[model samples]
Target: MVQFEAVLFDCDGVLVDSEPITNGVLRQMLGEAGWALSQAECERIFIGKAVRDERARIEQETGQPLTEAWMLAFYVRRDERLRAELKNVAGALEAVIAAHGHTAGRIACASGADKAKVVMQIQMAGMAPYFEDRIFSGHDLQRSKPAPDVYLVAAAHVGVPPARCLVIEDTATGAQAGLAAGATVWGYCPQGHGHAFQGLGVARVFEHMDALTAALNHKTSHGNLI
Candidate 1:
């Protein structure tokens, strides 16, 4: 059986059910900025991407650069809305607790969001206790997900060798980062992106949180290090 020393999770879609809410806010903010996009379009474009990358893409596509002041305003508005609307993914907190129990609390969140946003979301979801002082944000790295830098840094911070870390991600970009970091990656495809994740080198895919828990238990029980 494969051994794992730590569990690294992607924050937005995996732990907190904030993708839909965040993407909705993004759509509105971009719409007001003269980029009218449907929710699906926003998700397709921005999900799992770092803010800098998204900003560059938007500027390229719209032929207009967003001002720093406007970007700050968007962040303020998004954070305000997320504070009012964010919720934990169903069964996600339970899975985290269980994973923590199994792994002896070697858990860390690595996300392609700013640290402030990550901390805010985790605290708002009541999951700050699980990841307190164990969070790694894209802003901490020169390159974010789909580039491997953040995950590699996260593995180092957790004191786990990349090969001995198990990364749980909910998007292709995040899964790719895990793989590139040399970790065994499990894609949580609750919204039915199983095929996409499969193509991204995920070792496994689970559509439900319970399935993920069971998989972790089975792996550790079969001589895999927790």
Candidate 2:
């Protein structure tokens, strides 16, 4: 059995390779509404930001009403488009869930993605039942990633202490959040990472699920790899 009792995951870049597609959809949606956002602007002003923050920024930038109706419309459109293009991220669903059940560990998802959208994506990908009861969204916490709220909540919800929980994350913000919550944070740095996460006190860096499996196996010596 693995020594760790709980596993936590980030949703977007970690669970699904949907960041590029999500933003691409966003750019198209806003462009159709007559507001074309630059790439830098899309990344800088967005990326890991919660919907509330994004809506405020959008209204501020475009001098338009980023109202509830607009939010609903964008969400509906993204959901419609994303279900057809759901891309799995680097063995995320398979390896993570496999490790969880293989070792009797409780697996939870803590993500910067909003709650509704996270549910939609997970449901669409058929990964919901694996973690539905343990899902933790950024919108539920006062402070998002890099602040520790979401990860801490996840650890608590799954009945594990921060130290006994392992967080699998793919971004600096998410890794920092996990570490801040007092957990072992592993940075999953696959190819084409836009930002570097080398200096974030990550327990280890792995580019693939095989490396992650090896690291987890070495860390937990109680049993052989399953």
Candidate 3:
């Protein structure tokens, strides 16, 4: 049995179902900017990534400079769609509660997205109370996911050693960040789409949030702790 002192969650696909909404808005905006990508193409490239992180690719595809003004516009449009359509991932609330109880509330959300967007999504999903003041955004760090900056910061802020943190992530980029930060990362692969996490160093791949809650409970029932 393994012990974890904290639980770190990646917000987008793990906690809330906001990716489709955000990606739809992104695809629409990119189309208006001269890159007419299908929804699948857009999601394939941008899911679990911050828009600015792919500035070069976006510029190359759109044949236009990636600018702050464009990003701001995207944020505005994305947030508008999110506010209207965001929903908590199935069993996410239960999973969060289980993790919180398992770790005595030493839980934090560490995401590669913008802080405002992350905060808004959590609030919209009614998870603000659990994650309030404990949300860490890579946008505020020197480096984002796949670099370990945000997860490291979150582990530090939660007063847990990175090695003793359990990170729940839905993307390879995020799982890599958690692994690089010295945490045991679990891949949350809802709908059986576990391909992205393949070859990634996640300790487990689960198809639903309920699986996470059950795992946490199993660990507790088995008295698995250092």
The lDDT for every candidate, in the order shown, is 0.81, 0.75, 0.88
Best by TM-score: 3
Clashes of each: 0, 0, 0
Per-residue lDDT of model 1, residues 67-154, tens digit only = 7887788789888888888888887887787778767888899999998999898888777887779999888778888888888888
Clash-forming residue pairs, model 1: none
Error of 3 at 52 (Å): 0.7
Q: How good is model 3 by TM-score?
A: 0.94
Q: What is the TM-score of each candidate against the true structure?
A: 0.91, 0.84, 0.94
> What is the alpha-carbon lDDT for the whole of candidate 3?
0.88
Candidate achieving the largest lDDT: 3
Model 2 Cα lDDT, one tens digit per residue, 1-226:
3457787888887778888777877887777766798776776556666656666666766678778887788788788778878887756666666657744758888988888888777776668878867788888878987789999999888888999888888778788899999998777767745246666788766667665565455554221221
- The lDDT, on a scale of 0 to 1, for candidate 1 is 0.81
lDDT of 2 at 97: 63
Identify the superior model by lDDT, candidate 1 or candidate 3: 3
